[model samples]
Target: MMRFVQGKTALLVSAIMTAMLLTACDGDDGQMGSKGDSGVDGASGNNGLSALVSVTPLAVGHAQCAFGGQQIDTGLDTNSNGVLEMSEVDSNQTQTICNVTQNTLAVDLVGRYQSGVYGLSAAEIVDYHPLSQSAFVVNAQSGKVDVLDLSTLTQTAVQDEAGYSLNNIAKKTELNISVDTGLTLLGAVNSVSVSGNLLAAAVERGDALGNATQGNGIVAFYRLSESALPVYLSFVEVGALPDNVTFSPDGSVLLVAGEGEPNSAYDVDPEGSVALIAIEGGVPATTATVIDFKDFNIGGTRNSELNPLIKINGPGASVAQDLEPEYISVSADSQFAYVSLQENNAIAVIDIATATVKRIIALGLKDFGLDANKIDASDKDDAINLQAYEGVYGMYQPDTIASYRWNNTDFIVTANEGDARDYDGFSEEARAEDLNLDPNHPQFAAAQDKTQLGRLKVTTSMGDENNDGLMDKIVAYGGRSFSIWTAEGQQVFDSGSDFERITAALLAMNFNNNNDENKGDSRSDDKGPEPEALAIGQIGSHTYAFIGLERTGGFMIYDITNPFAVSFVDYVRNRNFDADFAIDTDTGEVEGDASLAGDLGPEGMKFIASQYSPTGLPLLLIGNEVSGTTVVYQLRLQ
Candidate 1:
């Protein structure tokens, strides 16, 4: 059995940070800028790979991320409006836009799941496959990797999310049925990567159930076959709690972000660092290298307080206090690695070659949306002032990083939801969760701050108003659904338009009500926004993003090509039929929800150009976070 992390929410933290590692061509291709004072110079980073800028400009092939999926557990709403206007498949919305017709894809987290309709959960499916033929989905509640093969006509699982809560997976093709050691760690699977057939997993230390921690603090490996159990490899001890795992572009080196032994508690080493696991001659379990972030920043006290802010429960009452590495994603070329320091509210960048600290980029700023010179409330409050913030985690928690790559450059985007901190879900004795978990408990009134999270508006682009590279205007939105921002964190588009429609929907839906800022005796003054489901991909150069409102149905689209004037274009409702499998289980026929013509249930999206039309068309990969499984749809000009 697996044990829960010490704190309320222990996650992999990866904030946004972009850097490129290049080399001098034999000749002077002055085309590239002067190599400035080269820092972290070494082959530690997987060279040959270029940094990605945006997720536009598709690559050839019938499949450009063929489909998409997302698990809705966190904040999907923006404006804190209390309605589920985002879609039809939303939890509270009885009407659905899923199975309107035949041969369609729509999944409801609960509706489609209870009957074993679709094999998925509310906290599942974290990534897509590099081969584009499979989805490396994870059942976070359980260490299971649902390797769903999208190649054939039916939904046959190659690997179910059973054995472990498979956080990450890597395929090393070099092992032709060799290096077979089937040893596996329970919660250690934080991240995974493939380096020339060597599958590396960054395992978290500490026995979750034990009062005393017990993790080796290393980057471990497992050999594999297209089938059969995995082969055991070796481990390289690095920092405290190593949470994120990724291979450099060339697959030569492995970049790992350590949470410092206590992935969610205090760091045992006090040295926040990343480890480099080298793969020499394609052999498994080679030597490992370490890069210390504290070592570099220690040059002066100006940076002391910046050491990742870890969560603590008084001195040592066993209440669980630890720092954690939420997520880590490397450049396509493997030159730079981005790690999310969730507890610390920071993003750490690693230069593979030199195995040195590049820079630590902070996430969120309280005053992101405030006009630089405006005399606004957010500007005046010392509490909300945001200056490329690293967040105050006494309670408020941030998480998740969705990266978008354009051209050769890449960018890491972060999602800051509430939870992960102790908000009592809005209660006085919330730490006494048993009381707070009670929806009808009288003490529930004391628990008022449900909207613990908000968009980190970080920019001023007309399109990116209050730009944090995300649509902050949605803060006025009810139901925390998906919001699209420009590559530069500008306001791109929100699944729901104005607060009226959005809140009306959120309130009607009755989802995450305690999270409403409108409640009395709250932490932050009422901003009045409803919450929704989590969003997956808004990559490709498309018109908008399709959103999934838990019950209102699973489909909401945003016109993003034009950041300014970005509006709600489509929405789907509760006409769902495709929740469990690709095949229509209801009538044994294809179930297509045409209700999505105008406004429909569009939970999440993967951009794709329509075959018939040459212009950019988007494919809406829809799924219900609470009731059903998932569905796929195609979108066009209204």
Candidate 2:
């Protein structure tokens, strides 16, 4: 953590002089010892320093300082040494000596924990058990959940011949899921959720050759133990390619999102569905209710309410097989579950009581013609530019979604991190500059209209107008922002250009850079920050939303108490984008231990309120995928 001292220099100098005078004359002189043995050690000197001195500008006219990792309120540092002296220690008295110099509240990086190999890969999703004061981290590649004891966490500084480094140490234990299942379960752990004493993890099972099993997935259940560990309880079989798992508000049900994604060959695709497993007295029901979307096929007339811009047919697949469920969020009343159909650009509402699909909310295209919706649409661009153009549309294909309530109304928030249906056998991508434009369309009168449609990369699956089998309009991927929608699927609010504008303002040195720390607009043409995961928590009297950026490697905080007028609170990144990549000289490939400058590719996060927090302060836990690390941040009101 970075520390700063703010106050009047003149006042500080005077205080130091006064402290020196007091130190010289205030101590009582001991009786002179005339004859002490040469080897005798006098009195064991006063037990070191009674107190460490530090001075900080009063926060709201009250002294605040941190000593020995604990925040304390002490009087002025009369010695001007940023440490409290024994004479200056007075915890009960308010310090009125220093004047307030700064008004901005700041976030301090109090703790950080590492998971996998330093430079390799490790963590993805994390869930915290407030009662046990422990955190569960999903190690996706290793197929294990590492349980970390938060009480053992300590901050230490080590100095070696090389240099001085600060480290956060904690005790950890791992529970490997593959040890029991073996090759039968070929995929990595995708997501995890915890409620009460139960923890649920979604594991995508497949064959020994790594081919996805036909509608086969596993939900591993575990019981949280008082020993700060999880004991395996049982497992339940569900649909194929289960990407996300969640628990109902009351913990009476477990919801799984079966993505059912196809193979690279574009063959043998399974239909997407949702599974609801009822829990009775901490035990799963004998049979799970699988809610499939075959009835709501894209080609069916009843499903025409879906975005007409969506391509009805994928490679070697039908509409029903293409709606892949990505993530899920339950209603506050536990009556409905909202699932994001990422690839289809729609949201599926499932009735928990009936265990059936109630409705599919289509998230229509985002218009880029307006100034607020402008984007830097080309990776080839040298600099970041936000400008509007005609005939450009983007799909709000959200990856992670959450739910909140305000004024008794329910709302769904989404991270529009766009995805494409690209496989080894079939890919649907095209550059706008390479496609032939429709002549009759008013926007593009000529074939070479560079201003409107030159550098944009669009999907060829949609935007075909005039029934001439020609591409008249361009459809891009991702909205590059977070959005709020009504339960009925109407758009309520969109962050629009705020993400880019705010990020640029905060991270001016590395704006629009990738996780590798490559500078310039390398990712602007792509998903642009790729807002992948979202978690909301209530702090004080306000509700805040934490949006994690997948590519840019950090999270943004927003005060969303009023959805219509959300305000940006802060932006934090823990990754070392500027660190040098270790490379093998012979093969020219990156090698060996990498620097843990910060967290990268945050896939999952959890927020703990102060009431349940071990530190008596709000906390945010993040699981970063690329860096394979989990970091715990203590939130303080400045």
Candidate 3:
């Protein structure tokens, strides 16, 4: 109930009562009348029928805000004008509302789209065009992006007596990345991003023989239409293996992460880099500013500045080549970009205005010895056994990352989905039991048994610090959790074991299940749940972080309005646990009822605010790689 602050009626009544007492006392000549028993306080007025709120976007350089925040105006509709006017606003309530926490938000699966192709990357990365009311999804299996029309997508449109059709939604068109570009080779679209009426796609280059090539990639541009496929504009050549791409918030720049992954034979290695393309007049510049990491190479100027904890383990590869930039996130002001170096377990800060590397912050290891950082370290155990091994640690090898502002300060969020350098020519991975542990180390006997810590995968390069052949400390691949970090890469909060604990309690039967197959406890030895995809959104002053669990087939939401005081909000999974969706032993293929399997292996996620949503409600779009499906969920606030 909204109370009004007014003094007209109450103050007038008190004034008249005082006048009557003064008149009565005047007749007694300098004698004051006794206060007749303090009169009872009048009852408060009823609340107004409705309280209205209006939000206006603030511009840059505002003295009272950072990165141009929202200006909120709230008032009671006294005149019933159906809009909050300046005169109706209460003077006492005029303020800039910031970070009001709420826990009433939930998500409901409203629509889904299936691409028929299973076990292939039919849908990997997804981006939406608000004006077009469509989603541009990266279909790596078909070498194109499948466009799905969401203008008519509704709960009723997708529902029927026999349930919804596998192909309920309509595929508007296929956006082939190689459409207008003249140069042709084995190409694959890795990522896509949309801003306003423009769309950008990152395409990786391959050798003519269809093998992975160590050559420069390309970032293609297009013009989004209201009811048709994107019109190709132009393409700019970037670094090797452009894995991820995104546009700055202001649409002034486009950034691409050149992963520069080496071939399986380890024959050629390219230097990882970032490309900054200036977007002018709705088209990319003729060339891009390529920012390479050569300064951090061995014996280079910045070589001595390297952090000791940053991993540089690639065989015969310089620091430039070993530091692979997997993902990119730009600050709200578009002044800087944070590039996640997954293999190196670090993040590179790039000054956008200067197009130069400002610094590289190394993400430290997570000590599992702490009680809060426990893990279920065995798939062969056949049960959820969460324990803390004293000598074990986890690398915060983040795959996808994002940036947000809280209280006008920037913070970064990462999905600590660890990766290993396992290839045909070089492999640094081994099961815990396969390696010989130091006899004097704690939990040494437990590491030797398959049902305990033996099944966990660990990197072989770091444990033997003394080069004594016997491992001293076990360093695992991924952190198995998400973390909030300062702009300088200092970890502020880590959801240690929350993912495992929540999944174990809610999905005990399907604990640690793999995405392709429904075998419980299979991924426990590997990265549990593998939080890869991430997106941040704001609803009614509260900010939320949505993390996608790649293996377990769902997403988790957390209240991140206060990064230091984060809390779990909701967990939703659409996969059918009862369905027998397992890989075939003979063909090594996932064969089961595709319709019942639901969405699996969420590779990419995008959040749409209410204003840009088709239904005028917040929505989340996810692209599931293994199941080859794209699903949509509407945010429902109670």
The global C-alpha lDDT for each of the candidates, from Candidate 1 onward, is: 0.35, 0.71, 0.82
Any runs in candidate 2 off by more than 4 Å, and if so which? 1-106, 116-121, 153-171, 181-183, 208-215, 298-311, 439-455, 582-593
TM-score of each: 0.47, 0.78, 0.82
Q: Cα RMSD for candidate 1?
A: 23.6
lDDT of 1 by residue, 43-63 (tens): 343223222222122111102
- Indicate the residue-level lDDT of 449 in model 1: 26
TM-score: which is higher, 2 or 3?
3
Error of 3 at 359 (Å): 1.2
User: Against the true structure, whose lDDT is highest?
Assistant: 3
- The per-prediction tally of clashing pairs is 180, 11, 0
The 10-residue segment of model 3 with minimum total lDDT is 59-68
Q: In model 3, which regions exceed 4 Å deviation?
A: 1-103, 155-167, 208-210, 583-589
> In candidate 3, how many Å is residue 277 off?
0.9
For model 2, residues 258-355, the per-residue Cα lDDT tens digits are: 99988778776887889999998878776678988776565665576566644455776766788899999999989999999988888989999999
